[model samples]
Target: MTTILEAKHVNKSYTVHQHEEHQILKDINLLLKQGEFVTIMGPSGSGKSTLLYNISGMDQVSEGSVYFAGEKISALSEKKLSKLRLNKMGFIFQHSHLLKNLNLLDNVLLSAYLAKNSSKEVIGARALRLMKQMGVDGLASHNITQASGGQLQRISICRALINNPDILFGDEPTGALNSSTTAEIMDILHDINAAGTTILLVTHDVRVAARSQRVLFMLDGKLVAERNMGKYNKQQNIRAREAALSDWLTEQGF
Candidate 1:
């Protein structure tokens, strides 16, 4: 498989008052293969999100390097990095983070408009297709307040896929949803991964992690364990996978 992203000896630290350093992420190494679905799980303050940010180039590593598409992204300038993120990567946060003033369709089209790699007509068509695939096409002109939490998240997924990104980075994407809604979102994400968009997600829910092909456990800023669950199939027994993962996580002291 092709390596789409790689982190080498990555470390991140923050300087508190009086120049005292607070190390957040320890020496981390990881590689994300193309079209793989991977999840990261850990207790709060375990630096799970920090590792996601560093590898996605949303935050700079204090030491070591990150590479995307075989290029050293950690060494790139902010402008170039921003462009790379816009064109090559996609992000879905816990919150929808939609603009209150814009309707759902416009919000989905926002990033594609900024990217400018294609005409408005082309991008709009693609955005509409994604919204349809996500089952939010009917809510196109609706205000943000009018949609349910699940619908808003589906809209956000539409926005993330508007650029046809090589990889999707999700930070607790379903964290705000109810169990049923989380399952729905996970189904959509599973379909997306099956359709060949690489996904890296940070999640605490074992149900969510079970849908992924691999799960990495973090502890005190270090990756302590990983479980390869293999490809997810709707026809298979999901509860068994979740139970197995729960057992392994227990072994890892999670």
Candidate 2:
């Protein structure tokens, strides 16, 4: 498969009081292939979330570089990077973070409208299509307060895909959901990946990692280990896949 994203010797750090340097990510190198569904798993404070931000250009790297579509994104100007994110990348945080001022449909169309790459009619149609596919079209006219957590999350996913991003970066996208709701969101993600959008996510949930094609284990700001669990198939034995990943995660001391 083609390489959609790459991180070469990526490092991230911050300065605190008295100029003390605290490092969060260390010599992290990664490659995400086109159309691949991958996840990063680690304990809290292991820098998994930090890595996601740096690799996706949401945060600047202290050292090394990140590339998207063969361009060195870490070196790009913030203005260019923001434009790139708006055009080619999508993001989902732990919270929906939707704008309460705007109704659901308008919220989904917000970034696309900012891109101004298409007419309102075209973007509106695509936003509605994505909302319908995610099963939240009926909530379009409603404010965010009118929806459940799961419904809001689906709307967030629609918002993320509004511009047809090449890859979706998720930071624990299902962390706020109940068990059944998590399953439903994962199913939606599976369908989205099957439809050819690459997904890279960070999660503490074994079930979520089990559904991915590969899992990368992070520890103490390092890429400790990775396992190719193979592609997820709804027709396959999911429990068995989860068991296999659980055992591997155990060996990693996760």
Candidate 3:
């Protein structure tokens, strides 16, 4: 299988002043294969979100490079990057960020509109199918304000999948949900990955990270370690994962 995404020694820094720069990431390398599900784990300020933004081209890197499907993302123009993001990548955030005025069906179809790929009739059918798969089809006529947190999250997921992206990036996807809802969402993501979409998820939740096929641990703006989650149960997996994380944290004196 071909690699769908690659990050080569990617570095990023922020300038708080004219001469002061804060390094947020250093020599970060990552490669994601088709259908692979990887999760990034870290404490606050670990540069997890920054890495996602850089990979997604929402933020520019200060050094190194990002490539998607063998094309260097850093070399692309903003318009080209937007096109790539619309057609090749899907995103799920901690917040829904749904359009308040659009009905659930329209909200999901908006992704197709942004990609400029399908007619209204085609997108409407696709959106309804996605909503049904997500168990939100019954709420298609409802507005964002009318849905529950879980329902809205499901709708957001439907919106993300409307474009059939090859790669999915999720930031704290289950952070705002109850335990049951979290499990539901996780199961849904697992099913999606099983259906062959590459997934890169960032989260502080041990349970969520434990479910991934691979885990990357980060601290102090760098990737400190990685672990394989092949056969471990959630308890054993999280314990081992956190131990590796704790060792890295202590080594860095963080």
How many residue pairs clash (N, CA or C atoms closer than 3 angstroms) in each of the candidate models, in the order given?
A: 0, 0, 0
* Span of ten consecutive residues with least summed lDDT in model 1: 220-229
lDDT of 1 by residue, 1-254 (tens): 99999999999999999799999999999989999999999999999999999999999999999999999999999999999999889999999999999999999999999999999889989988999999999999999999999999999999888999999999999999999999999999999999999999999999999999999999999887889999999999999999999999999988
Candidate-wise lDDT, in order? 0.95, 0.96, 0.86
**For candidate 3, lDDT tens digit of each residue in 1-254?**
79999999999999887889999999999988888899998889889999999988888999999999999998899999999998889999998889998998889988798887888888888999888899989998999889999999999988888999998899999999998898899889988888888899998876676668888888888888877656334355455755655564456454
- Each model's TM-score, in the order given? 0.99, 0.99, 0.91
Model 1 RMSD in Å is: 0.7
Candidate 3: where are CA atoms >4 Å away? Answer: 231-254
| Every candidate's CA RMSD | 0.7, 0.7, 3.0
lDDT of 3: 0.86
Model 1 scores a C-alpha lDDT of: 0.95
Poorest lDDT segment (10 consecutive residues) of candidate 2: 10-19
